[model samples]
Target: MQETPFTLRAGHLLPYCMSDSNKTDFTNPSTFILLGIPGLEAAHIWISIPFCTMYAIAVLGNIAILFIVRREPSLHVPMYYFLCMLAVTDLVLCMSILPKMLSIFWFNSREIDFNACLTQMYFVHCVSVIESGIFLAMALDRYVAICDPLRHSIILTNPMVAKVILAVVLRGSMIVLPYPFLARQWPYCRTNIIPQSYCAHIAVVKLACADTRVNSYYGLFVLFGVLGLDAIFIAMTYIQILRVIFSLPTKDARLKTFGTCGSHLFVILAFYIPGLFFSLMYRFAQNVPLHFQVLFPNMYLFIPPMLNPIIYGMRTKQIRDRLLRLFTHKGP
Candidate 1:
């Protein structure tokens, strides 16, 4: 008996021998390799510098936001509480990907075990969904504050905020829990080389040897169900907010109301625009260059965490003042 040679075709290893049955046996791959950017392996060092800087800023900035919110008594409002939640999500989001990303870029460490890959995928998708939910919660907070200021405190009390946080975590976990489980059951007999720097759901699903239609559709379902609904509600809330703002008696009143939502709006746009673009590109633009496919998703993951704290600090007066006071205070 003679063994046929395996050929590399489109990143997958296919056996040259095919029987009359037209069937090929595929065993599960023990590990997967993450190919960091397709064409810029030579410049990975250069890429790591900015990525490292972004990671540092994201972690430290979110930590500062957390610290200031905790210490400042005046900052203990629903808005600040939501901001703190966003800060924590951003921190976890960045921490989930950046360390592994930096290792891939700097140390050329790309091989990940099957279970570890699934774990990373689970957290990445879970945290992203949670962040989207948080955005919706913040939008609702702004809506109540602007649309019905008299009842804002009564509606979004400390207990309510706690419940909302708990709900967000539960919803995100439940939706994202199936992704890894489905992927794990599928046998991966392909090249086991994920084209992106991280274990994204779509990226991992594409590597499975079995039919992935269910996985793909479920991903879309979660995408539309969670993020799409959140986006629609956020837009509706802003629409209501706009109506209220315009109905205000004075220009000062309208500006004040609009100003309260600036930070949340900035963060929302910063997060969703790129996120939608990357997702659409992954789904529709199959012919897009590998580097671009890898690049956009990385941007989607990296940009928000790095920018959220800055946007909140600059746009929210209380946060800005608290940050300044924390840095500038002289001890007695």
Candidate 2:
């Protein structure tokens, strides 16, 4: 007897290929088959083009940001320190997914070791949690700079930023640490083929015959705890910053003050909006079209890392001047 190769379970489009043996109990497969994009397999090559381009930009841009920030002593401060954290987090986040995904698309390498898939799943969510915290940190930097300019330096010292980063890392790591462990315990007999291009927790755990609601619940908890709480705090910080900016005495003063934050706000929006959309789409929007489901998550992952360095390079005058000087080989 055979079961349907795929099904819509709680809005996930995972295809579970049943083994002919169809053992009723749990069995761990040595590897899982990664189908790049289930419904859009024909366009995998075309899709890889843009994904590869974005990955290249993410790598080069973030490395440049790190190099420029580190080389120029004048650029060393809480703001840039937090930015370095952001660069590192973005680098890790993109690397966790894009390389494997590209391999699937380009080389037709789809068989990922089960343990390796769990590792990917763990880092994918872990770094994402770290990214959200970095954004919150960035928002805090801007908030203090704008609202309490006189004490900004004192309030956000290098030591303080170090502590904050430590907290962010620890919290993100702790929150997501259980994911792979919990995933490992689940008994899988349903299918080894995950519909998504990458090894997401939901994509993998859904294959288990045992009840996976615990995994799902904990995933939700992490979403709200890290991304959700961090987002709320960021919004609140920006609101206070806006209040201070508008209170400035002159038109140029207002514009200039707000300009300092404009790029950050743009970056935050770029990071959060699509992410939240994808998160909700998967949780609630069951009947959403398949291509969109496949495409949007990849876009959400690919766009932010590529854009962050470009945004800071163009928008922050200090970084921009430094980049120009670095490129022109002009000594200040």
Candidate 3:
């Protein structure tokens, strides 16, 4: 007579390979596997090249922005200080996903060790929080400049701006740290497949062996906590800005103030709104093509960094003039 093998409720089977007499659940091997992008060999060759090129561009562009800010003394101010931090976050974000992401795309090896996968998750959330915080700080800078011009110098002093920058990064880190920790606690079965280009929080959360009700709550908290709070604060700041602008008697003054903030406002909306929509679409919409998931994250993560320099260059006469002078050796 054959003995029955015990089953683990989470779609996991106890050691069925061993001799029935010697088999024991206590010594059963449990290992996680990554079901990376489907249709492996074709995907590997077709997808990896473009993704790698993008990664290189993201890293190099942000680094160039950082260098320009550092070398140009005239660019030193609260706004550019915050801009530098934004670039730093982008650079870190690209670094977090790119190396392993390229490896996955090019090589047939889809095996990411538990620790490594978790580490990537940690960075994805951490830098996302940092980006939000930086945006909030930029909004605050605009608010101060517009609402209280006379006090702007006093309010945003050198030492003060430095301290605030530090606070923003630290605060963001503290808030996002919990998500990865909670995510890591869940026991993953062997078939832990993530369908995206990178280790997204939602993608990882879907792999929990235990009920993800708790994780869903945490995920909501993260969604609302980071994105929600920042959006509200930014909206309020801009509202105040609008009120201040309307109060200005001179057309020229209003135009100048609007010109100063226009680029930042556009950048913020470009970065946040599409991302929020994408998140909603992913969660609510069923049978979403894998490409949509793959495309949106890249748009939010990569596009903003690339757009920052371009937006600032086009809108700000200074950057445009400088570029022209460098290229054409002509006067603005």
Candidate 4:
């Protein structure tokens, strides 16, 4: 009988080791190799700078939006309420994912622990879901404002709006926490190398030894159930909004309605379309290069958060004016 001479390297830390059916003695590698962008050296050099700039702008922009909304009494309407909620979610998203991603890019070390990896993945998914739900709520707010203008205040009073936001946060949190749990439960039998900047669900699940049928189905259920339903609701809302806009007597009124929703519509499409496209690509487009997988998912994940404040500020006159005033006000 020959015994396997196992040696733990200086860099690799393993809490447990096992020999699988592949007849290969697999020990946890010291550093999970990140197969980064293949072609461009400039791409790698320029990537982190842009990411850091975006992160700073996103955090400050969103926090500024939040403070602007909080300080301005005129902006206390339901629309701004939803905007504030969106800003909060965006801030959370940046905080949750960016630091670790930046660390990976800067340190050249991607050896995250089982627990830490799962934690990052969990928050990323949870916040992603929450942000999506918030978008749905924003769409509904727009629907009410445009379609049922007379009852907008009554329908979306502070208390009711608070409850709706609470429900969205809670529901999103509940729906997505399970994904990380199920992901962490899987035993890694294959390569532990994740090719992306962050720990994504499908990426991690692909390394599992056990069957991932349950996780795959669960993810699809969530995708269709939460995001799909939100898409349907948004479509219906916009359809009715368009209908109502067309029926308006004055061009000014119709334009005003478009102005109200145009920013949100842009943000929504910006976030979801790319996101759904990437998800589909992952499942079907196996031939796509690994670099694109890294790049596109990061865009899908972070760009929305970065762009939301800019979109809203540009579109909403009150917000724009307030931002200018806040910045310009140096009175002691």
Winning candidate number (lDDT): 2
What residue runs in model 3 are displaced by over 4 Å at the alpha carbon? Answer: 1-50, 320-332
In candidate 4, what residue range of length 10 has the lowest lDDT sum? 1-10
Candidate 4: list runs displaced more than 4 Å.
Answer: 1-43, 330-332
- Best-to-worst order by lDDT is 2, 1, 4, 3
TM-score per candidate, chains pooled: 0.91, 0.92, 0.82, 0.87
lDDT of 1 by residue, 130-228 (tens): 888899999999999888889998999899999999999899889889988888888765557776677777777777777989977887777677788
Better of 1 and 3 by TM-score: 1
**Model 2, runs deviating above 4 Å:** 1-26
lDDT of 4 by residue, 38-119 (tens): 3332466578788888899899889989988888889998888888988988888788777876665676555677667677
How does model 3 fare in lDDT? 0.67
Q: State each candidate's clash count.
A: 0, 0, 0, 0
- The lDDT for every candidate, in the order shown, is 0.77, 0.79, 0.67, 0.71
Q: What is model 2's C-alpha RMSD? A: 4.6
Pairs that collide, model 3: none
lDDT of model number 4: 0.71
List model 3 lDDT by residue over 38-129, tens digit each.
33436666666666666677676667567666756777888988988988888887787767666766664555766676677777777777
